[model samples]
Target: MSKSLLLLFVAVFCINCSSDNKESDTPPTEEPLYFPPLTGTTWKTKSVESLDWNKAAVQPLLDYLKLKNTKGFIILVNGQIVMENYFNGHDAATNWYWASAGKTLTSAMTGIAQQENLININNKVSQYIGTGWTSTPIDKENLITCKNLLTMTSGLNDATDDVTPSALTYTADAGTRWAYHNVYVKLQDVVAAASRQTWSAYFNTKLRDKIGMDGSWFASGNNSVYYSTTRSMARFGLLMYNKGKWNDDVILNESYFNEATNTSQNINLGYGYLWWLNGKASYHLPQSQASFQGSIIPTGPNDMFMALGKNDQKIYIVPSKKMVVIRMGEAADNVNLALSDFDKTLWTKISALYQ
Candidate 1:
């Protein structure tokens, strides 16, 4: 072959290789996060086919949810509803109780109060509500901080759900032990005292209203449970998925949000600031002192975190997938609080959709 012709052929090959490299180096465009309107029933949705998800797997998931007694179920991707279903006489307009999952709401509100200088989580709980709030001795009680309460490491007894002074007996030194106790509700009183506003009022002005969430705290026995439509719970999960931001608004600082989702203490690696974390090396359960080895949900994404409640209410947020899943209704199987066998089975089914 002629030298000039050979040189031209080599030049063409080099150009083609360079173009291929450029295409491979460029990052894929990500979908922008969506925020639904503040009012009306309107919400943006994406079809499973559009996302290239397993359409065949979708029905099985819905069937399992209904069979397990889920009244409302929603799956959001980048804040857009992808799958929503209602079962057993429930609909989008129906409100369901959040049970212990409502603890995440209190955690977020506490962070807001701290950012406004109304309270500091590191400070003793007694500092805001004054002493004698618990039956623990003065020095022992003083050792408990709002942060400890948020992490469920207040070392308080979990024998009773009651938070009255007479019932809040001590179990161990603050921060030295971890137990899932309803004593975290005292953080509500702390915020109320510090901000000089009722817990609901402060929550409305700072978090709920700002995010366009529709919900109200109601008295259930000794606990202040939150009841909201399924979509409202998804809204809160979306906010957390974005690290406490709604559109351009900074509702809670990113730093606090990170702390609230990650492990808050060494004792329970699977728990955060009222949030249940997955992918941890070890974890502790609601009423058990035994430390179990392995992630909270092995089938779930490593970055997933959850707001789990009594009777199977769940808000599962997976940052790796930019997905927020919500489920509300009675117990899926046997009546239980927070984590259950349902989680493992549910994730196994959910993994099929995106795997």
Candidate 2:
């Protein structure tokens, strides 16, 4: 070959190598999160094929949900709907009760109240509501802080749902015991007293309206339960999944959000500020003092946190997967206050979709 032709060939090979290097070095862009408008029925969605998820697993999961009497079920990925279904005479507009899953809502409201300087969670409950709130002796009663109520460490009786002063008798000194009780509802009273606004009023203005959720708290016997459309529950989960942010708005601060979703007390590693955490070493159940070993849901992602309610209403948030799952319905099998065998089995079905 001529010298000029040999030199020309070498130059072309180097240029080709350089081009390939540049292409490989560039990072892949992440998909942006989708946030639905604050006042609209329209919501964006992605299909199973687009996500490269197991399309074959979708029907089986839906079948199981219907068999177990699910009223509504939704799964979101990056704030977009991936799956949504309603069963047993329920529809998109049908409202269902959140049961104990609503406790997480109260937790978020308390955090907001603290951020607003209306109340400090560290302060004694009696400070806002005044003394004699509980029948416990003055010294013991003062030991109960707003944080205790959030953590279920109030050390109050869990036997009765009644929060009347007489029924809120002391089982042990506050902070030393962990028993789920209706006493957490008192935090609403504390917020109302401090903010000088009705609990529902404050909740509506600060949270519901901000996130475009439509829900109302109602008095059922001695409990205050929140009822809302399944999509509304998904919205709340999306906010929490974003670490208390809604698009451009900072709803709940990140500091409080981290504390609320992690271990809040020593007794139950799986229990947070009314949130049930997965992948904890151990956990305690409502009305039971014994500790159960292992993660709350073995098949669930380790990083997932949940708002689980009586009869299996749930809002599951998985940060690692950028996913939010909502389930609202009657008991899957047997009546349960919170965690049940259904959780493990349901997670197994959920895992099939992405695994």
Candidate 3:
């Protein structure tokens, strides 16, 4: 062949090779975010479909608790869903407020801070915020420690302003007694101040995002409340179920997770770092006689933990059974509503299904 013709053919081959190389070096498109596998997908009910909870006895319990208006419920047993139901006008996408139930989340964040060496719950809270945390009588405030805040024994005069207290007076010596108040809410601010990040940012980057939880700040310090869909709440419960590991990722320090869920505080019979325990010792009613505090469903296993909100938002995690039961509803304290009894009944019915 002629030299010119050979050279032309060689140039074309080189060009083609380079083009192919470029194409190969270009990264392949990534797959979209992973959706968790659905095992009992058939049980997922639409708002229009009647739930399969067929026990005749369950209907009375539902009527008693007004489950018709329930937003959503997801029950998991041994990592498989035993039941998942969404009622009228509600679905997995709807974000629900955790209210005081969110306090459990705060406790989790505190453990995260300790893991990162940003703050220690055992340290004196006053040490991080200075002596201003001291009570009006001064000496009493010094006794207040970060542990008091975690355990809700800070002794701060939380009666007047629970959410945002401009002056946090250690009314009594810390660790002297127990009180369920918003004074502990201020610890979120203290945590943010110490960590130098907003509550939302810290939680999302550290906890939610890592755990694949689609959660947002529904509320905070009586002001910035966080909101999350029921599925997201379930994810948190599942994460805790595995001892701070979610989807094979360790989002919280295992040590902290154990400490948070374990019965640490003595004020509430079933209280822990911020989560509630399933001990019947804290029962306040006949409904709770079959149920327990600190979880959405009372019939859940005894080793369960929960994140409870004021409006009946709850995330219940039972490590022993590998179960998570989540419920979100409107208990606005409006219309003279009391949801605890209803919740107890709902749990009792759900427990029957597992049996």
Q: Give the winner by lDDT.
A: 2
> Where is model 2 more than 4 Å wrong at Cα?
1-6
Tell me how far candidate 3 lies from the true structure as C-alpha RMSD in angstroms: 13.2
TM-score of 3: 0.74
- Evaluate all candidate structures by whole-model CA lDDT and list the values in order: 0.94, 0.95, 0.66
Clashes of each: 0, 0, 13
- Name every residue pair that clashes in candidate 1: none
Scored by lDDT, model 1 comes in at 0.94
User: Per-residue CA lDDT of candidate 2, range 62-97, in tens?
Assistant: 999999999999999999999999999999999999
Worst 10 residues of 1 by lDDT: 333-342
Task: Encode model 3's per-residue lDDT on 1-355: one tens digit a residue.
Answer: 9999999999999999999999999998943222353232232222212333445654554453354466777766544455566776878677777667777788888888888898878777667777654445656766776778777777766565444435565556677666666667657776787889887788888887776577577544455566787777776777677787665566787888877877676545566786766744653221121323454345556777777766677787766655678877776234322235655656666666445
Q: lDDT by residue for model 1 over 1-355, one digit each (tens)?
A: 9999999999999999999999999999987999998788888999999989999999899999999999999999999999999999999999999999999999999999999999999999999999999999999999999999999999888899899999999899999999999999999999999999999999999988887889899988778999999999999999999999999899999999999999999999999999999999999998999999999999899899999999999999999998999999999998586888899999999989988
> Cα deviation in Å at residue 145, candidate 1?
0.6
Runs in model 3 with CA error above 4 Å?
1-68, 133-135, 218-223, 280-300, 332-339
Listed per candidate, the RMSD to the true structure in angstroms reads: 2.7, 1.3, 13.2
